[model samples]
Target: MGMGGMRRQGSDFEPEFFRIFRSIEDQQKRSAWLQAEGMLAAAPMLRARGLPLAADDPGEVSLEAERAAAEQQMLEALVRSGVPFLLAGPSLAAWTLYPEPGRRPRESMDLMIHARAVNDARAILRDEDFVPDPRGATRTESAQAWRRSKASVQLSIRLRWDFCDHPILNRRFSIAGLQAKSVVIEKPVAGLRALGVEHATLYSALRWVDAVHERFRLVDLFDQDLRWRMLGKEKLAELALLARQRGVAGILAEHLGMARRVFGTPVSTELLHSLKQSGNHERSGSLLGAGRGRMRYHLLGALYGRGLRVRGRHLFSLISPG
Candidate 1:
């Protein structure tokens, strides 16, 4: 779902405020503010509304347990329905890449499925009482999401499930490719599948680029930085090769460069040089380059790329209180 459509009913800040915050040039200040807001403000606000703040927060322990149970239940349901899926995004990151506990409390769980199975997946979710989130939905895309909730501590806590038929980064990498490249995680949640660290790294980088055009979230940068730190140099070389094979080498390089600039991510110089030498970095480099290079042009282009209907919907949502 676009950030434009992701308003919480009781949020103190408008969704547009988040979009503006992302455009702030000061990375350190933005990260610090985000950390403070997440801990002192967003967590309490969400917890008061019966949302899970973090897996390790004492006040929200019950909510965390319920979320875990709900995730397992949903996974078991999908397994019974015979739908093939791999959990993606922050949920996977929390389990594998992220180092600290409760560091990233995801608001939703992202699932990737083959395009042909989307209807089946939707049916399964509906069977479990998940309803479509119209505010965050579009009719044409191969992506759809639903939300399910149960009463908790006088209010209700919600779990969101996002189903995507295409790779989260570039649509060119097919679901079959993702499935073939996925790795299995057996503990904490058995039979769980996730993208390999190399592929996941590339996805994280592309996701950062997406944030550059849409809404910037510090968590996105942190995910890349932490994952890069964990994956180290050899894995990055593998990621570079995978990006080349997937035809997203330039895009990968461009975002990696951005991560270095914005968060001081430690991408190896050799990998950067290798990617640039491949001659595929020009398109994304021109569009999402660091500092003052063509970012405004690209942002405008991205706004236009969302099309009139989506843009109008966002504007309308921004202005309407409901």
Candidate 2:
């Protein structure tokens, strides 16, 4: 989560620069101002609920600055921690395109943990005062939590099944493999950070890039593209080899296609055919409906051909074109 090349420079100071910056183009500055106003507007609500806004809260002007700094510190801390994590959502965006602090980050700090270690991670978080979400009826389900501090810093935790860590894929990874790819950062929050390329590549292939999923997130594709572009061919090959060894050849193949489509780098045909012949097909389409199931063949074929880009606003726009 250290600063990526996308951080905004002094030239982005103009309000108009934010307007065309994609996420903030339309109502970016307005949204930031709204958040400032909302904080101020909530005073009545807080008072009605016996939680009056502090008179010495430094008013809206200072409050925004304070909130931004607090969030930045938390991000720094996350980067410093040695825990395996990746910047997802708006955090990644902010890191990539250096946005103004007043522009609220849209995504939270999302970290991936092996499903098997979820219990252990939850235990660690609980000790830090993160209680499990009680919204669901079942108590013994997958773990999740959200916590906030008096300073207005927010934290969220979710335990999910990592598509790359599947038994099939794990078998081929080297001793250090994904574990060796982590880096330690010292900002926003300190923690272990994984290679953004690997994280984004795996994420797009497993979930976002596939035609089977309906969720269209151009940001995810763009993030993967950015990371992949930053990662030269050698690193991409190493990742491909790692995936192939893990028996997730198919996923990696698809990932390469996604990289080519979104980032404009074509993956080899040999790699594509190889993965299709290696991975388990049953687990691939379990979540997709029939239409999506049909879409895969076409997408796969197209991947073998020209490949697609992350741009455009079609159904495939939400997903990686390959």
- Best-fitting candidate, measured by TM-score? 1
Q: Could you say which candidate leads in lDDT?
A: 1
Q: Write the per-residue lDDT of candidate 2 for residues 1-322, one digit (tens) a residue.
A: 1111212224322222122223444444633433432323223322443432344233543544455565565545444443344444434433442323333233234445556556655555555556654431111122243444232544444443343222222223332344466544443444535435554466556544233323344344444544555667787777676655544556555555544443344455566666666655534433233344535433433333221321112224236442
Scanning candidate 1 in windows of ten residues, the lowest lDDT window is 153-162
| Each prediction's number of clashing residue pairs | 0, 42
Which lDDT value does model 1 have at 51? 37
Error of 2 at 110 (Å): 2.0
How far in Å is the alpha carbon of 307 misplaced in model 1?
A: 13
Return the TM-score for each candidate structure: 0.65, 0.48
Candidate 2: TM-score?
0.48
Q: What stretches of model 1 exceed 4 Å from their correct place? A: 1-57, 60-66, 99-102, 138-140, 149-169, 211-214, 261-264, 277-282, 290-322
For 1-21, candidate 1 gives per-residue lDDT tens digits of 123221223334333334445
Candidate 2 residues lying further than 4 Å off, grouped into runs, are 1-72, 75-105, 113-155, 159-177, 186-192, 209-214, 255-322
User: How much is 169 displaced in model 1, in angstroms?
Assistant: 6.3
